[model samples]
Target: MSPEAPPDPLDFRPRVALASLSGEADADWARAGSEYAGAAFLGGIALDEPTREAARELVDRDRTEFLPADPVGFVDEQLAALADSPVQAGFNVRTTELEPLHEVGAVCRDRGAILEINAHCRQDEMCAAGAGEVLLRDADRLSELVAAAAETGATVSVKVRAEVPGVDLPAVARRIESAGGDAIHVDAMDSEPVVGDVAAAADLFVIANNEVRDERSVREYLEYGADAVSVGRPSDEPAVLDRVRDATEAWFAGEVEP
Candidate 1:
């Protein structure tokens, strides 16, 4: 008899994820396999800084050490360091150009990592350059970015904010799916039902984010159609991570009600 088929790599749910912790650079990479998080999103990298001065400011504001010089290489190193662990590395990149995103996607493919495009940033600097929330107003542009990243032979995911006023979340999900994006990481922001709507509207993976605290929150999102749930501010505490991990395990075992 033939051996059982392996589970899809991209389909692996990141039950507990480390959402781009901005303050400490070293701590971020070190927490990859901390026996808690199944995935780490190394993030908010400026893909196309206008100048070195701007880059410095971005690094300071985002509280990240990554620079434009070798963003992909940085992600590669992070992935390499977690080689012996079950943790998956995903790079969150901010860029307005399709070509650069395509390049980053290729690098992610080569480095065995996932590439997440940033559409969630609300900072003035990012929006002024049409790199973040601006993409929401232009669905065609957002879809183009997804298509370009997808063309790079890597599993591409778009990170978006669900609370963006006037932005149709389901429409955005459809645009990402139609553009061949592998997943939609929604910063749901207390909108569990909207997550379900997105999942219903699109055929891609859904990673729900925002205010996830315990088993109840995890089960709530999962039942609401989130393939996975992400933790942000609460993850700063080790205890919180522990709780989330246990909750995720129970969730997977069907011990937690959906």
Candidate 2:
């Protein structure tokens, strides 16, 4: 069979995504939860030696991690398992080097999946290794990573965290857009209005995340100009997903208000 084109990041039907939760999110989790979401991001997979070691450190601290021997091959395996699901599949990956991003982007490109750069992980181990939240403060390097990922023809998204002191997320959003990124997934933390800031700054598809449990949170994010909303920790709970899905559908259908 021929390879399929990458899924359109801006065209999610339900406008809800199943966010990546470190070690828990995978093809199986995403496939089972696909019915309630328009997109499902799997794996905050560590792609390089430094990040892999950081992941190992996280594991020692009782955190889950995907430490595959062959990072690119692992992505292909995981994405292939989602081939029959209706939800758009994506991989949230961490790497300090540009080569691994390019390699994984190729896999995502061929598999019709989104390649999400991991800039939102706040784990001390990951940050100390210069992989996750470190990228939030280093917009120039993050932009280079996004550009490299985009070069492989995959739809690229940067998963970012809001409210990091000294980091201007809206400014970073513009850089991502200039780097050819197709989407920006923001973990809006306590400051939900940052979603609007990001939306106003760039033409990138904005996916607002954090504390999205029901119609209220869903409506709030959408009202703030987010193109979509993502469910984080509760993503594994079908009940939560159902409520989120309904709210998202309602918002898009004009049945809800701010």
Candidate 3:
């Protein structure tokens, strides 16, 4: 059964966040919504297949963005590097087939910014390891991981592909809530072509990404019920975020609010 959705109350207002698409962690963090005066996300979710041959084949390909060698450590250093910025949210660190997430969780908790557990990645290697979408095949275990991380007092948010029959979006959202996740971040599949626009499933606060980079699109997602929206990639042009931020500011200002 699909999980139940969160209630339609407790509205929030978080500024726009730019998903770090720039290759350099420093550059990505540095850009962290400064121009837009909003929020920033560090590191793109890592889709790096552990095997070398597969890794080479997947670089900069598809919806996946692979990471450099040593993902766990990379997430650590990147977190440290971004310490002083207004930016807080960092992308999900893969823990599917990988081992020992305790140390990783500790690092993120220390930084005061929560780490996202990626259950949405569709890349081949991540899938092969029973990570990402593969985890969707087993919801109970996914709930455990989300709950365990939350126990650390470190926020746990799962990024997932849209709910297929077994994936059951509403049920999963409840598991996430039961697991103590502060929010749910979904990268909607086959979302509308408009930039920054999203197709939200329910009332849960959504941090929707992919194909979002402008004002109107942001409004579309908000209309669909996203608490906040994530921007990146195709919208890398400067001011893409500025326009979005302006629109968001205006909306939240009670002027032209969605």
Candidate 4:
């Protein structure tokens, strides 16, 4: 008999996700914030040796980090913790090698979760280690990683940051689409219109991130063609989520003009 087909990658319920914030986004945090979100991406976990060392250094500097001895096992445990949650779960992971993506992607596939490749982090330690924003400049490598993760049959999303000098986000989005990526989680930073540029460039699901705190911010992103928006720093704030959720619902219901 043939193997079961993978589930649709962009099957989000409410069109809002709790973005992964390094060190802080975990099962418990997800459980607490799941009520107002359709999905939650847990952890910007470091998956390989070099990246782990970089994460350790970040920790030494008082920055939050998730450094698990057994990276794949930690991901499995985190996803397992959210098994009963109503919100769809995902992991935002960083690694310099393709092997770890395959390993972690397999776990995500088994657990029916999204495996988000981290190209958005700009931490000096991470970038110097060639695991984060370095991927942004190397679209070929990023696409290769996305392709590897896609092979696991789990939904794959690439978390990318905008306004990085010389990096063409729309071009990168097209590359991800060709590599079988299901979504583009764009940290729009100060350039909100880039979300629209990416959405127009590829058919992939576009998740706008950064500054998504209220109705105006939510509507702006939706109007710019974002399929959804993710809350980062303020993800744990019930009031903030409430506003974003209501705005999303209102926009979809046509109560608000674009």
TM-score of each: 0.87, 0.96, 0.76, 0.96
| Global Cα lDDT for candidate 3 | 0.59
lDDT score for residue 131 of model 4: 83
lDDT of 2: 0.92
**lDDT minimum window of 10 residues, candidate 4:** 5-14
Where model 1 places Cα greater than 4 Å from the true spot, the runs are 1-7, 23-33, 51-55, 58-65
Report the C-alpha lDDT of model 1 over 173-231, residue by residue, as the tens digit: 99999999988888887676899999999998888888888877777888888878777
lDDT of 2 by residue, 94-208 (tens): 9999998989999999998999999998999999999889998998899999999999999999999998999999999999999999999999999999999999999999999
RMSD values, in order shown: 2.9, 2.2, 7.2, 1.7
Worst lDDT run of 10 residues, candidate 1, spans 21-30
Model 1 lDDT at residue 186: 87
Taken over the whole model, the C-alpha lDDT of each candidate is 0.75, 0.92, 0.59, 0.92
Please give the TM-score that candidate 2 achieves against the real structure.
Answer: 0.96
Task: Flag regions of model 2 displaced more than 4 Å.
Answer: 1-7
Candidate 4, residues 1-258, lDDT tens digits: the string is 999976564777688999999999999998898889989999999999889999999999999988878989999999999999888999999998988889999999999999999998899999999988889899889888999999988899999999999999999999999999999999999999999999999999999999999998999999999999999999999999999988998888889977
